[model samples]
Target chain A: MAHVSIPSYWKTLPQRYCLIGMKCKNCGTINFPAREICISCKQKSEFEPKKLSGRGKIYSYTVIAAGSAPPEFSEQEKLAGSFPVAIVELEEGLRICAQITDYEEEDLKIEAEVEAVFRKIYEEDKVIRYGLKFRPVKKRKSLP
Target chain B: MTLQKVAIIGVGQTRFGNIIDKKAEELFAEAFLEAVNDVDKGIDISEIQEVYIGNSGVGGGQLGNFSSLMTDYVGLTGASALRIENACASSGFAMRAAILAVSSGVCDVALAGGEEKMNDTPRNRVRYWLGISGDMEWERLSGMTFAGVFALMAIRHMHEYGTKREHLAMVSVKNHKNGASNPKAHLQRETTLERALASPMIAYPLTLFDCCPISDGASAVIVCKADLAKKYTDTPVYVAGHGGSTDRLSVFQRDDVTSINSSVVAAKRAYKMASVKPEDIDVAEVHDCFTIAEIIAYEDLGFCPKGKGGKLLEEGQTEIGGKIPVNPSGGLKSKGHPVGATGTGQIYEIVNQLRGSVEKKNRQVSGAEIGLTHNTGGSGGTTVVHILKR
Candidate 1:
C-alpha cells in the first residue's frame, strides 16, 4: 500500500471530487490534476480552473485479478473477485484513469459511454478516501 | 570542453534468480570481480576513479547511501559513488552517468552497475514496493498493478491493430527458447505456443507467461576513455551513442497508450548521435517487462512500422538467424528482471555479443557488429537508449 498523507489527500480533493482541470490560456489545453504550465504549448501561461462534464468513453481497460490489487486496495479486492479499470477520455478532451463501478464484464468495452460518480476509493484504519469512479451510462428507452 | 570517446572494456552479471544465501552487496561484489577479471589485460580495482550504482531499494535494506555501501563491500570505498534510481531503468541511467564521467574527461575509468535482491521481501510487501513506481494518487489508488497497466496496453493494441494473443505468446516462446541456451537465465526452459497461451491469467489479456519473474541479481560494467580502452582490452565495445527521455508518468495522461513515447524519443536521439538508422542495428536488447512492451518496443525502436510489430514477430524477423535478433540473452522475460540491475544486465549482454565472446554459440548473433539497448523506467515515464559497436 502507498501512504497518502491526510493533508495531501485533502489538497487534492477539489480535482478528485469535482474534476477541476487547468485550462491553458495560451494553447487552450486542459491539464487534469492541474499544472502550472501548459503541457501542449509548453508555455508559462496563466490558467483557470475548468470543471469537466464527468462524461467520457473508455479508451482502454483491464480486469485486475483478485489478490493482485495493491496493498491499499486489498479490502476491496477481497469483496470483488475481479474488477475492471479503465482510461476514460472525457468529453472535454482530457484523459483520466479510474475504476469502473457497477458494471458487468460485457459492459466494459472500448468506446462504451460512462460518467463519473462519487465513491469510496479506499479506507485506512483512521480514515476513508472518497473519489470519483466511472460507470456505464444507462441507455434511454423510446416511448410510444 | 571537448568530450572524449568512451568504451566499455568489460562486463559481468550474476545468474538471475532466487538465491537466499547471498546478500545484495555480496551479489554485487561477485559481479564486480567477474567484470574485473573479464578485462583482457586485467584491471586493478584501485584504478577505478568513480562508480555509479543503480538500485530501487525494493527491500528497504541499505536504501540510504546504497552506492557507498556497495563500493565499501567491494573494497573500493574511496571512489566517487552514488545511487541512481529510476525504477526498472535505474542502472540504465547509471550507465549513462558513467559514460558521461569518462567522456567528459572527469575520470579515466568509471564503473556502472546495479543490484537488487527482490526475492527476499514478502510477496505482499513486494507489491507495495512495485506499486509506488506508478502514479500512486490515481493508478494505484484505482487498484492498478504494473501487470494490469501493461495488460491495458495489450488489450488496446489488440483492439486497434488486431494483434492476437498469439503474437504476445510468440515473444514468450522465443525468449524462453533463447534463455534455455543461456546458463545464467532465470527461467531456462522453453515452452510450446499452446502452453504459453494456456497459462493462467494474471490480468485480462495477460497470462502468467506474459510476466517476468521476480529475480535477485547484480550486474557490473567497466568503462574507460576510448583512447585508453586498448590498455584494458584488445576488443573494446565502443559506446557510440546514448540518449534518454521521460514522459508523463501515468499511462492515461499520454496521447497514445499503445506506444511509449519516451522510447521513441530516446531511440531517435541515440540513432542521430550514432549516425545510423534502425536498419543498421545488428541486434538489440529491449525492455520487455511485459510481452506487450516488446511489441511496442519493435515499433518504438523502429524495428518495424507501427502496428506491425506482431507481424514482424510472426515473420520470424527478430529471431537469432533473422534480420535483427533481439533478446539473445533471453531478455527480462527469461533472463529475469531484478529491477535496478536490469539496465546494466542488458549492457553486459550487448558488450559480450558485440565482442563475439558469448559462451553459448547457439544464442550468439553471428557477425554482430552493432547492438542497441532500450531500457524504460515505470512504464513509459523514463527511457534510456544506448548504441554500442565493436
Candidate 2:
C-alpha cells in the first residue's frame, strides 16, 4: 500500500499529483479551491471539475519567520524547514496559490517556472490533512 | 440636480501612535478642539448642528451610543450626534455623512470625526475583528487575512503584469519619507527600500514594513453649507464630488488584481459628479493600508496607467512635483492606520493639501486648487471617493 491515501469521500485521487480547480462551463472561468457559483455570469450549477496545468510563473513570494505564520503552518514547518509561499500563474490563465516544497526559499526566483506536487501539510491527533503545494522545476529532472 | 457644494472650513487631529490610556470621548474632544480652533475665526459648539464619528470596535466597546457622548465633551449642549462605521473606512464615511447632512439642508454646520484607542487590545483580537466584514465563511476558513488577501493580490499583480517588490518598496520609502516630515504621523521615521524589503514577513510577499502599523488616534473636520461657509473661514475647501461603492468580498470575485474596480467606480462617479478628471487634480490622499494598495490606487484613481504604478513610484512621479502628488501626509502606510480613524485622516490630509499647510517642506505642492481622498472599507468591499476644491 502507498504511504499516500485519499479517503473514501473524494471522487478520485488527484491526477498527476495536482491541485484541482473548477471551470465554469457557463462562463469558462477557472477557479481554484473550487466555487459553486460563477461570479461573472451569475450562473450556478454550471461548474465542471477541471484539472489544472501545473506549470506556472511566480507572482510574488516572501519567507515568513516561523512565529509569524498561522499557528498551524508554523508547527508543521517545524518538520519541513522554510516552506516557499508563491502565487503561480497557470498556463490556463488561472492564478493558483500554494506553498512550495523541495526548494530553498532563497534559491527561488520570481517569475520562475514551476509544477505542482500534492503533499501532506500537517496531521493531527487522528486525522490527516492533505493538500497541494508547489516546487521549482528541476532543470535536469524532466517532467514525467 | 447637482449636489449642494460642501466646504471644509476646518480640519484637526491628535498625535497618531499607540494610544491606549485614553478613552474614545477624550480623544474625540481633543481632535474636535483642534478643528474648531483651525476655523480662523471661531466655531461655537452650539452652532454645530450634528456630529458623525467613526470608530472600529475598540476592545469590543459598544459605540452605537458613542456619538451622543461626543456632544458633552465638545460642549455642544443640544447637538444631535451619531456614530458612523464602515470598517477601516469609518472616518471616510463620517466625512460623507457630514457632507450629505449639510447638502441636504438638514444642518448649516456639522462635525465629522473618528477615533480608535486600540493599543489596549491584543493584536490577534484586532486581526480577528478586522476580518469581520468579509465573507468569513470562505476567507477566514481559508486562512485569508486582510494582509494575506492583499498579499495574494500583490502576488497576482506580479505574476500577471510583473510588478516588482523593489517597486512596491518605493511606496513604503516614499510614504515613510513623507511621514518623517509630519510631526503628527505615527511612524515619523523614514524607511529605505533595502530596509523595507528586509523587514520580517507578515504575509507572503508582504514584509512588516510594507504593512501599515496598527495605530491609535483621532481626526476631525468641520463642514459647512455653501451659503453659510463665509461665516466660518475666508479660505474654505469645497467638496466637489462624493461617491461610494462596494466590490465583491472575495478576492476571487474580482476580475483583475492589477486594478481595484470599487476604487475605479467610486472615483469615476466622483469625477463625473465633480466635472473633473485625475489630470485636473492637484493632490490626492489614496488609501495605502499596504504598499500594494497604494500602487493599485495610482492606477485605480487614474493617476497612471495600469501596470505603471510601480514605475511611477520609482521615478518619483508621485512626489510633490510629479503628475499628482499622493500620500504627502504619509498615507495609511506611514501615518498610521487606526482602522476607524484612517478614512477621516485622509480627509484631514487632503484638506491640508488644499490649504497648503501639509507641514513637510519637500511635500508641499504649491498652488494646489483640487485634492481628493480615496478610502476603502474591509479589503475593498466598500470604498468612498471625495474630491475637494479650494
- Residue-by-residue lDDT tens digits, candidate 2, B234-314: 878899998998887666555676677889999999999899999999998989998999999988988888888888887
lDDT of model 2, residue B316: 90
**Candidate 2 ranges beyond 4 A from true positions:** A1-38, A43-65, A70-144, B69-73, B76-80, B131-135
Instruction: For candidate 1, list the clashing residue pairs, or say none.
Output: none
- Across residues B312-382, which tens digit of lDDT does each residue of candidate 1 receive? 99999998999999999998999999999999999999998998889899999999999999999988889
Q: Which ten residues in a row have the lowest lDDT in candidate 1 chain A?
A: A1-10
Q: Relative to the unseen true structure, what is the C-alpha lDDT of residue B238 in candidate 1, on a scale of 0 to 100?
A: 97
**TM-score of the first chain of model 1:** 0.93
TM-score to true structure, per model: 0.98, 0.82
Residue clash pairs of candidate 2: none
Give lDDT per model, in order.
0.92, 0.78
Summarize candidate 1's per-residue lDDT along A1-144 as a digit string, tens digits.
337787888998999999999899888999887777787898998998889999999999999887678888888988987788899999998889999999977788999999999999989765999999999997878787
